[model samples]
Each structure stands twice: as structure tokens, then as C-alpha cells.
Target: MLVSTFHRCFVAVCILLLSACSTGYHGSFVERSFYQGDITGLNLLGPAQAEHCQSYALYLFPLKHSPSTQLAIKQAKRSQPNTVMLADISISDTTHWKIGYAKKCINVTADAYGKPPSTSNG
Candidate 1:
């Protein structure tokens, strides 16, 4: 009975270790914030300008550091985005908003979320 218990414990430990390692396969993405105020009073001159402005919020999510990142960057480079419209006049009192573009460097890691390893040789 003791031998069987020990074997079960050992298997459980191995499974936990393998599960931790498997998380390294996925990556993460970050979204930068933009406010409607900063981009107000700007003109977006194009045939599809109105449609682009309607979906502007979708552009806030940056590319993840994975295969998808390459594709997103390529698409962004090909299409230049223009700004249009301003914050609603009723909501102009808010000044704590931020608007800008951000570029993140790709980091390779052997752990999840590109976090550094917990164990170090030193």
C-alpha cells in the first residue's frame, strides 16, 4: 500500500512540472490607451475615413510577440491611419486621458508572459 501511494505522488509531481513547462509556448499582447480628445479637430481624408473612425478603438490593441505580431506589424506598416473628430463637447472636462502610439520590443523567454525565470544559477 505504501509503494502504491508513493507512485501516485510521484506521478502527480511529474504532471505538475510538465504543465508548468507547457505554458512557455504561449505569448501575450498589450494594448495602449488613446483618448478621443487628443485626436479631435484632425481630418482623415479618404473614401473610407468615416468607417475607419468608427472602428478606431480596435486599433488600440498592439500586436502580441508571436507569429501574429509579424502579421499585425506588416499590416500597420502598409496602412497609414489618420485621425478625425474630437471628444464629445459634453465630456471635454476630462483631462486625465492619454493618446499616443507605443511600440513594444519582442522578448523571447522560456516562461509564460515573457517573465524571467524564477531560478537562477547565480
Candidate 2:
């Protein structure tokens, strides 16, 4: 009886742990990247690329918010930091209901391009 009870408790604990195991999602495709921090605006030269991030709370409600321009740009910079970000910023987010998640997020997007050759130190 004790062994059975222990097994049940262990299973319950594992289930709870798995439910909220993952938080935050990020994905990017970059030819090259480096952090340029905050900038006033982007001077696009090359073709533009965009990166957006969706930050969540309980993972169920799509929490729409602001100030993600810097965050989004930073993420984009991570993809190709040596590039550019045009000043058109958009913000939005969505929620995905999975078996174990009630996901929410805030999305930020901006146009980007490779930096000029003259801007490179190395």
C-alpha cells in the first residue's frame, strides 16, 4: 500500500512539474549578428529581415503590450546585429492552448538590413 501511494504521489509531482516546464520562446535566422544596443532609427541598405518575440504570462491570454521595440530589435540584432532596423515598429501577441500550457506573448517586429562595409572595425 505504501509503495503504491508513493508511486501515485511521484506521478502527480511529475505532472505538475511538466505543466509549466517551458517558458518564453525565441527563434532566429542570421547570417551574422552583434549587439548594437538601442538606436534612434535604422538606416536600411541591404534587404530587410525581421524578428519578433512573444512573451507570455500564463500562456493562455494573448497579452498585447508595448516597449518591445527595443526587445524585438535586440532579438533581431542577435540574428544580424551588424545590420539595420527601419523605424516602423509593430507590437502584438497571441496565445496557444496546449495540453500543458496557457501561453501568452507580446510580439515586436522591425525591418532590418546588413550594415555598410565602412561600419565594420574588423
Candidate 3:
């Protein structure tokens, strides 16, 4: 009887620990965050998105270093080779934590723009 009771208690503890895992999200947006030169010649290609993540071992030491907006932006730019700037940008940060490990990620979504094809409408 005592062995059965101990097994039940262990199961309860495991359930509680698993239920304690949590996740959080934060988001921000900007009109233009990655451009500076002339804007009159740029054409909106389309929407683009990318994600960058960093994992923590033992909930302390980083495994893939820290996630950053810069890395996310770089990843996003890869989808479109002609993308020279981003507009209507949105950045979302997510964090998930458990008993043994944690993860942080950055998701970047933006409208990619670049120079249009040169043509003479004359």
C-alpha cells in the first residue's frame, strides 16, 4: 500500500512541475527602422519574416548566445535578395522557461523594399 501511495505522490509532483512551465510574448512596431538614403526610388516588394533564437542550458548558461533584433533583421533580409530597406516593421520577442532549460527568440516581420527596374516610359 505504501509503495502505491509513493508512486501517486511522485506523479503529482511531476505534473505540478510540468504545469509550471510558462511562456511570454512582447511586440513592437515601427514605421521605418532600417533605412537612410533616398526613399523616392524604392518599390515595395512584399512582406517578409524571419526568426532568431537562443537557448539556455540549465536555465542559466546560454547555448546559442543571446537573441537580438539585428540578427533577426539579417535573417529577414535573406528572403529577398533585392531588399535594401524595411518598412512597417514589427518585432516580436518570445520567452519560454521550464525547470531545466529556457529559450528566447526574436521574430521580425516587415515590408521589404528596393529600387525598381529602370525603364523609360517616354
Candidate 4:
């Protein structure tokens, strides 16, 4: 009886580990303008990228709210405080699972542009 229980538990653990899966999604840009009106006067602030992730326990109970592209974009824009808008935006999603833990993420990548921060020379 003891040997049988041990064997079953070991198999269960192995199955749990093997059943975990991971997937990634390559999303395209949505039909939306980064900025309305003309952008001729905006200065390029180079590229910015950010990711927002949410965790799940047992794939059923969420540890937090689902990640969002808007949050990711906001995070990316934080890198440049003066950034007024983004351009050439792209979005993607990634999911990773291991045992009873899982994480899903929203990733945003874009070119940030806005008026440059003024430097005060002393």
C-alpha cells in the first residue's frame, strides 16, 4: 500500500510538471493614431518599450488584474517624461506557465516623440 501511494504521488508530480505550457502571441498594431494633428515639430526621443505582467495561481485564480496594452504604453512613456505621444507602435503578448504558477504579459514597443526638455545652463 505504501509503495503504491508513493508511485502515484510521483507520477502526479511528473504529470503536473509536464502539463505546464507556454505560449506567445505576436500582435499587430491597432488602427489608431499615436498623435492627432501634425507631428512635424515634435522631437524624436528614440524607441521605448515596456511590459506589464499579471500572475495566476493554478491557472484559475488571478493574483492581479490582467495586463493591458495601455498600461504598458504608459510605462514606456514614463521613460521620457516629456513624451507627448508614441509612433510606430507595436504590441505583443506572452504567457508562461510552470507548475501551479503562471504569468501573462502585455508588451508595448514604440518610438517616443515630443518637445525636448530644456536644459538650463548655469
Candidate 5:
């Protein structure tokens, strides 16, 4: 019984460690920018060339529009950091972007998916 329990514990520890390492932000520079009330224009950087800024902008749209429910805003306000480190993994090239006031920070990232539809195609 003791041996079995030890094995379980070891497995749990390994799983936890792997998860912890896998989960977290992987971005270059995270900055805070002014929100001009338009959530669509926020620029985000990532791996892909064209979609990086657009991806981040899309991610931040909800946060700018609905600041009340956003956890990042709350955390930023509570932490009172000029810039908070973000661990978002959905962004392309592992790059992330942010924009907001000192009290709030909106998270944005580059899209990891295929290139955004070209304008000419539309």
C-alpha cells in the first residue's frame, strides 16, 4: 500500500511540474497604451507578420468594451504595476501585446492560426 501511494504521489508531482512549465506567458514586450474607446485598433505583436497586430487587437476588443468583468484589469488595478507580465500562449510566435491605463491592462496576442484573409480576397 505504501509503495502504491508513493507512486501516485510521484506521478502527481511530475504532472504538476509539467503543467506549470507548459502554462504561462511567452511574449517579448508587454506595454500599456491609451484606449481611444475603440477596441478595434489596439495593436498586438506576434510571430506572423501580418496577423500579429490584428490578433492582439481582436483579443483586446472585449476587454476594452467590457472592462468590468475583465480579470486583467482588476489584477492590474490591484497590483498597481506600470506593466503586468502576461503569460498568454495563444499568440503566434509567442508574442503578446497590451494596451490600457495604469489601472487596467488589456491582453492581446498574435493569431497562431493561418494568415488572416487578405484584403484583396475580400
Candidate 6:
């Protein structure tokens, strides 16, 4: 009985850790926060006016899908996300079976654009 209890606790802890790693960003980012150098020469396929476009991989808990969107916005390294456009989350239900619990993972692709950071003349 003691071993079973310990096993359950271990599984719970593992799940918590995995969930934490997936939520890397929060709120928004400032113009200076992005590595502008990276976006400039990224060779974006389509011609964009002010913002750069990029794709980000997201794994969300279907139920709490909002946070994933925020994370994706940050991934684009955009100071202002004019719109958070995301492709349909893959329609797959397969998950890793662990202790009879299925862990969900789905890819969320996105495209974003915004005004570049301002250069202050301080």
C-alpha cells in the first residue's frame, strides 16, 4: 500500500512539471524584448509591411486553450500582436497513456505581425 501511494505521488509530480514547462510565456512582450536581429533576416516567405511572420509549436490542454495563444504570440517576438492568428489545432486525440490518464499534445501553428519597435532619440 505504501509503495502504491508513493507511485501515485510521483506520477502527479511528473505531470505538474511537464505542464509547467509548456507554459513558458505570459502577458505580452515589449518592443525591446524581441531579438530584432533574428526577425530581420529570417527570409519570411510572404511580403509583410511592418511585422514579421513565424510559426510556433504549441501543446495545449484543450480545455485551457487561451494561455497557449498568449504563449504563441510571444514566440513570434512581436511587440504588438495586431492579431493572434492560429491554425486549427491538429485534430488528433492520441495521447501517451500514463497511470490510465492520457496526456494531450497538439500542434498549434500561427502567424503574427506588428509595428517594429520605436527608436527613441533620448
Each model's lDDT comes to 0.32, 0.50, 0.81, 0.80, 0.35, 0.38
Candidate 6 per-residue lDDT over residues 1-122, each given as its tens digit: 99999999999998998677545533232232233343443322222112212222333333333234334334433322433322222121123444533344332333333333458999
Error of 1 at 73 (Å): 8.2
Give the per-residue lDDT digits (tens) of candidate 1, residues 11-86: 9998887456334434443332133454333443322101111111222443443223333333332233332321
Model 1 scores worst on lDDT over the 10 consecutive residues at: 87-96
Query: What RMSD value applies to candidate 3?
Result: 5.4
TM-scores for all candidates: the values are 0.25, 0.38, 0.66, 0.70, 0.27, 0.28
| Per-prediction backbone clash count | 1, 9, 0, 0, 2, 0
Residue 48 local lDDT, model 5: 22
Error of 1 at 15 (Å): 0.3
Which ranking of candidates, highest TM-score first? 4, 3, 2, 6, 5, 1
Q: Per-residue lDDT for 64 in model 2? A: 58
For residues 1-122, write the lDDT of model 3, one tens digit per residue: 99999999999997777445433356889887567788888888888899898888886578956788998988887777688888888999877776888787899999988875568999
Q: Worst ten-residue run, lDDT, model 2?
A: 24-33
In Å, residue 111's CA in model 5 sits off its true spot by: 12
Instruction: Name the better of 1 and 3 by TM-score.
Output: 3
The TM-score of candidate 6 is 0.28
- lDDT over C-alpha atoms for residue 22 of model 5: 33
Sort the candidates on lDDT, descending order: 3, 4, 2, 6, 5, 1
Weakest lDDT window of 10 consecutive positions for candidate 5: 47-56
**Candidate that scores best on lDDT:** 3
Can you tell me which runs of candidate 6 are displaced by over 4 Å? Answer: 27-122
Regions of model 5 farther than 4 Å from truth: 26-122
